[model samples]
Target: MKKFWNWKNQAQTENSPAERTLFLNGTIAEESWFDDDVTPQLFKDELNAGEGDITVWINSPGGDCVAAAQIYNMLSNYKGKVTVKIDGIAASAASVIAMAGKEVLMSPVSMLMIHNPMTIAMGDHAEMQKAIDMLAEVKESIINAYVLKTGLSRAKLSHLMDSETWMNANKAVELGFADGTLTRDNGGAENSNMEDAVEAVMFSSRAVNNALQNKISAKYGKQKQTVVQQSEIPAPETNERNVDALLERLDIIKNHI
Candidate 1:
């Protein structure tokens, strides 16, 4: 619940458009082995606060997959057009979220990265195979988001993901990941063509695991009643392996939230 990506609305005048701003900075899920995260529920609440065109600012390393998926759906479902501006980098799950925007813009030196989904498992071959299948489907679902926005073919997107593609502002625009590079002046105002004010970066949870779980459930719901109950079969319990195993599972689970 308490992660860095706080959603806040800026004050607007009576005649100004009811523009809402979203800041996505940091990991996408709560328990990040690398850094902190931004949970999905809080994001949903922040996203629904206003009723006008929205702009999101993102700078993140990326985290949970399902959390990013749900956020993407929410933004795509919004009535108003959405614009995304990348300041630093939108890697992995963060890049997926960027695809939801109708117009995506990037700072001249900013970057975007995409790659395959990852998970950890300790079960026998059957369970391990299930994990692999789940990850593959996750990758496919991510590509769906990209294809919808960029009009890229499934084969090409898959290849890009496999390669862990990293693109710069111009390349992103050329590839359709971004509409254009943001044009600003010494006074920090957007060039004559840009009408909105630049949003400040806000340093941005555990809900990611929940979202990942939900995603897996939706795909494998037939297994929910059985698996959610019996999937906890004990692993060989020991001091070191137990800790490592739990951490790995957490690494994989937080994306659902």
Candidate 2:
């Protein structure tokens, strides 16, 4: 089985802080960590192998919520400060892991998304109902982590999740999902800033839908205008003759009546 995380030790320098860099680059766990005893233990051992702060770089579309929850618990319980930096996108289960960071920073171009928990069940009506209940409980559990970090109301968070909200760096900071935005310094080093130069910007499925609608309207609008212009043009001489013939027939019929 493949592991989902990589660890790198960075030497303490006078100009920078000493920290271990952990990269979570793909799916949370390609294979279930709970299935075997060895992998989880190995992950814990490596995490505890060093001292000082930890810098976690996350870039994942997310997978295996349970595995992500376990990772979150481990990072939250660590002795050193945990700082999470999103270099790409963190969606679904990966977003839960991001909540474990004491200070979460996002790249200016990175994205974060949150949505309701989902599962597949194969069984009768009772089993389906059970799955539904289980998913609701799981959603609540995930919300606990977000609430702790963002201090946002549960109702608001739930609505966001229901809508599958996506947020950019500034929007994440504004919503308290992130503490700030991460940028490169003059020394070609990464730096986190609380005050991003750009204002908070929100990106959602609704906005995408609206833009698509606008494009469709613009595309069809021209065609509709062309049809209207053609309709307004005077009728063909053949059509005029046909109309005159009909009018003469009507007059003859009236005279006979």
Candidate 3:
């Protein structure tokens, strides 16, 4: 709720004209606690306050996907230039919001993370399948944003999301997720309270195959090793008698010689 976002002018001095800059901290939510008053509409209202370029500073562990999607769309639709600066960390849903910026800048030490949308469901077999289908569609939607922003192939973006990829400023720029790294000197455009935005959050990144295998093992127990038994067959009786007869004839021939 209150910890969601902070909107402020980027420039503080009277000599410098007011510049619209939004500092997005903590988690992104569909609505603030209680009602829908503190969501995308509120953000748009704040954005309407000033003219010129809009700069957004994000440092969040990320939250609701729907909210992030709405904010992303709004920023993408904005007429003025939208600049996003990541001062701490933007992961998961926050990463999607980051893509809306016309120019994305990351602090040298900041991080960006992208991962598949996760959800919990309670259902029968058919309902489980439906959940799977819905997740597939959601994953596709997320992939679209990443593909448009990075110009990376959908397959590559999918693979990256599968692994819950994490990127630093330079790496983010290299991957085209960010335009450049921010270099702050004498408190220019950097967040004044950057330390307050820091968060320790881990991505749910255990290898899916490995996890499935472990679950299967736990359910069905490890497969038992098969043992092959060898058996010896005696020579055929007819063949043995024929060999004896041949040896007897050879002995008689030798005796006659």
Give all TM-scores, in the order shown: 0.68, 0.75, 0.69
Question: lDDT per model, in order?
Answer: 0.75, 0.85, 0.77
1-257 per-residue lDDT for model 1 (tens digits) = 54646554655668875557788888777553233244455566667766788888999998888778888899999888898889999999999999999889888768888888998899889999899999999999999999998888999888788767777776777677878777677856241322134322211012345566566645554543466568776545455433334556787899774
TM-score pick, better of 1 and 3: 3
Better of 2 and 3 by TM-score: 2
Best by lDDT: 2
* TM-score of candidate 1 against the unseen true structure: 0.68
lDDT of 3 by residue, 139-189 (tens): 899989998999999998888888888877777877789887776678675
lDDT of 1: 0.75
The residue-level lDDT of candidate 1 at 130 comes to 95
Please report, as a residue range, the 10-residue window in candidate 1 with the lowest summed lDDT.
198-207
Candidate with the larger lDDT of 2 and 3: 2
What are the per-residue Cα lDDT tens digits for candidate 2 across 45-86?
A: 988877789999999999888888888999999999999999
Model 2 weakest 10-residue run by lDDT: 235-244
Cα error, candidate 2, residue 97 (Å): 0.9
Ranking by TM-score: 2, 3, 1
